[model samples]
Target: MMDSGQNKNETTCAAAMNHRVTCNTFEPEGVPVQVRYAIFCGQSGIAEYEFYLSPTQHGCVDVQLDWLQSAYHQVLQWLNLELASGVFRRFLCSDPHNQAPELEAHAFSNPKHDDPPCAVSWVGQPPLPPAKVVLWAQHIDDPKGIKIKRDGATLMLDRGDLSHHWTTNATGVRKHSSFDQTQCIFEDYEQYLGKHDMTLADHVIRTWFFVRHVDVNYEGLIVSRRELFEKRGLTSKTHYIASTGIEGAPPMDRAKVAMDAYAVGGIDNKQVQYIEALDHLGPTHVYGVTFERATAVSYRDRKHIFISGTASIDPAGNIVHEGDVSKQLDRALENVDALLKQCGASLSDMTGYYAYVRDPSDQGLIRDRFKAILGDVPVAVVVAPVCRPGWLVEIEGRAIIAENNPQFPVF
Candidate 1:
């Protein structure tokens, strides 16, 4: 077993991304498939695995699931770590005439073009090893439907039906419209955190809402979320966390939204601040939405910058570079850089990125452009459309930079 003290590997933690923080990508030897694993060591001496797991084979649903589990276990055993939270992203197929049939296709496979069935965005930790790191997990109605991992303070919750991401994904057994279902999901997150001595309003640092058919369901989600936030003392007049509402299909019959989130409990208010590149982008409230452009959370030794889903928009909330994917992407990145600059960080500090393009044919353009610019950065490009039709693409990501501070706690 590895020592409880800072793992000997810390000596090798390269100062690639920033001082005191190491970042690297390697393929675990034993796994039969490809697993792109990124390791980022915290200044407080914690080993965190930020992994995007996928298989090279674009096959059937069962094959993808089996490979996913196998790849997952191989890494866990190889590193002697435990799984925390996971987001299982699948290629959704739709039948033009039938929602029921499309649901079957989503579960099975699209007959014509079999896309990569599924991939997982998962986080792992070293299991404490009798040290200061505290960890545990929580499951909802269907245990297999969700995966969650958390320390007492930093929580990563993923793929839930109804705390960090109590998604309605596992709550298909309940009959409700998208709006009522969103209400139930948010309530579940709040109550679950309450039982654990945490409150959603205080701890939730970031949230991702994956809506199926974003053009339609996103409205209900926004309405339900805005109302819930108001009740939780999170309003336009007060403050809200960074968030992304994009097109992602939930994994259950009659389900429409899946959620993933990160929260830090018992954190100092002074350590957190909202980022608004007011010169480049407008406040979300300029429309009817409620969320921050980015949120920066500081620990004793590092700072985390959560960039919400950003797109091409002017300070007046008007869409820019409409109908042009390349220009839109450029504008989005410039906006992201502007936001990160406020915290002495930039796009290069991003660990993971998700690019959602409304036009599937533009996938190659998005992929090539990012590859040329970001080089080796972990990016998941999906065919999910943005909430607005005028915008061709939207980007969201997380970035961490090392810092030296006599703060309250380590990240």
Candidate 2:
């Protein structure tokens, strides 16, 4: 749905030890814009990095950085970037297995914005691992004001006072059951949107939920989300937000669930398109869940597509290739292909990928198979459980396509 006169290009590569990186460039109105993302995996932990660049007047470049890691320190040194400013969201995963590292953190920094984000001092401290902190930078025009709010382990970032909203869990908790905790999270999210004069049903585009014991509790999580969506009048026919729910612990010891979300205000409904995969995959709601398989945001000159966490499920809502990892992966990739083609895109347009594997031993096999199918597209493989116990892996990715490109037919 993008207009004419824009250009986009993508490139990907892999470094030593299975580190992958990608660069996506866009040219709109004769201005060059670029984004780079890297994923590094090690024996100790895994890390993901993102950098954004835009040409600006006054010879000063506009840049933003976002980093996520299971364990920090090493990744910072590897990237050689300063971590002086930004906000950090931490979570704890895996309680019984002290052997598996539980601390995971995401930091964002935007140097051109208002003052850098500062640490919010809290009173009591829990007997848990220290929270890993980092900074994130973003590119925004002169803004009226930027506000930060913290409640217990939750942090909210209000950019330009109302244009953008981000909410994430700073630590983990276990005071309530998983269902109760999830409901509370959504309630708090709705309240935040209300204060900003926005509603979750119309503005939210993407959401990530990390739950402890995902295999056993994913259905309950889905039920809670569906109830919230129904209350807001957002159904499968009207379109639901894209989301990912995976196995991971909150930074706190007893917390069963944690969530992060992104929303953009003041956009026309026509610019946002909810996509289905050309009759090859079933709608998520038929299985008692509520989410879009993919969502496309059409700008004046380009279209940005976000694909959700996908596996080898067929149109009947049944898992295919029940016990074969290779076949499951192949079918998963085919599903993504269909989704992209429906939106006038192909695998070559992908910017980056995050592939989650349930078994650590299957990492190499998945990696090779992924490279064989998509060439060198940037990919980060992490050892995490999927929502279903029988599912071996899940993959998510993003793509940007130019409307004027004659090689691709407009959908």
Candidate 3:
């Protein structure tokens, strides 16, 4: 599903195989504004889909909902996919123009009939209306191995005791300051994992942190995270869960940070593999940060690859393409491509992605550029600053490569 206006020659396949999960990005024609849509195809057919709409000025709530619904249905029809009753995640950025109210209203109006609860996030100011939205539909068997529960705005999905939890502006036990809130979040996370008989160090794979003012408070978030990790026997020298920290505001006015995480319980080391890009990137902890560049989980039917928030940092830990957004985006994609290859996969296997842009004006250009290169991949673009001021863009994504295919290399 390539964008009609994009150059067909721009697409490339690193490795091609039939009966594998296929991914691509596209932009539909007649849409007044530019929006990037990522489509995914799995064994059971179109397993997931995502829409990344650019920021727009405040508009009528009804009109916005109508447009969104129409666009969503159009994509489903184009791809021959249907909306199934499963989990969907959405992230909407707030601004001075009251984008949250409009988004919330739309969200409430479109309730999940039989679908899983939608985890919503009202973060920092993005240039467009409805900030960003991510929807995923599982088309496989019924929810036999999965269980979902919603507590307030938090949605907890349990895959046979391996739980994934997402919450916005978490109310900490002591929400006095940034550090206190950070501590409170970690404490609660620890307790949540305990219920499933899993500890933080061994089972947690990734975490995302949205700091109100990341440049100033990133250190505090790191300190708190490190302290919690240390308590669970993880250290800079050892393995720490992969994470992303960026500038964004939570829904709560007083809250300074928001968090979401993925963890797996009762899985041995053989089932989970932590990956570090070979010769293309440096260890995140080399500069006092802690995380793997990627993690691969091997299941019976497929291998799931999780790439952390990647930027244009070279193998030696120096920021590449210093001040150029275009070059930085290319470098970032190159880094991600290398990581995917390491796991015996490629960009075509991506399920969905989140692209964070520091400059609002670069949104359209970047979206078009990515579509040209990646070919109809699902990408959610949000106007948010990277943790490092020098970095212009950061991307994180999940990809699944079907197992048992002769062409799909086994890790």
Number of the top candidate by TM-score? 3
True-structure Cα RMSD, model 3 = 5.2
Error of 1 at 284 (Å): 0.3
Query: lDDT per residue, candidate 2, 238-270, as tens digits?
Result: 889988888766545566776777666665577
Give me the runs in candidate 3 sitting further than 4 Å from their true place.
1-17, 24-62, 73-84, 94-97, 107-116, 125-147, 151-154, 158-173, 405-411
Which tens-of-lDDT digit does each residue in 1-411 have in candidate 1? 222233435423454233432333335443334444444555555444454454454544344445555665555555555333222332322221233243233332221222322222211111111111111111112223334443322233442211342222323226467787788777666765676566767778888787767888889889988888889898877789899888766655466766665555567678888998899998998799989999998766678889999999989999898788999999999999999999999887876677888887786698778878876566556677889999998998778787777845654
- Each candidate: what lDDT? 0.61, 0.55, 0.64
**Candidate 1: misplaced stretches above 4 Å?**
1-12, 15-34, 69-175
Order the candidate numbers by lDDT, best to worst: 3, 1, 2
TM-score of each: 0.74, 0.66, 0.80
User: Taking the tens digit of each residue's C-alpha lDDT, what string does model 3 give over 95-192?
Assistant: 52255555556642232222546455445646443434323332222223346667554556655524555554454535766677889988887777
Worst 10 residues of 1 by lDDT: 126-135
| Model 1: lDDT of residue 18 | 36
Cα RMSD of all models vs. native, in order, equals: 10.0, 12.1, 5.2
Instruction: Output the lDDT of residue 335, model 2.
Output: 91
Model 3 lDDT, residue 249, Cα: 75
Better of 2 and 3 by TM-score: 3
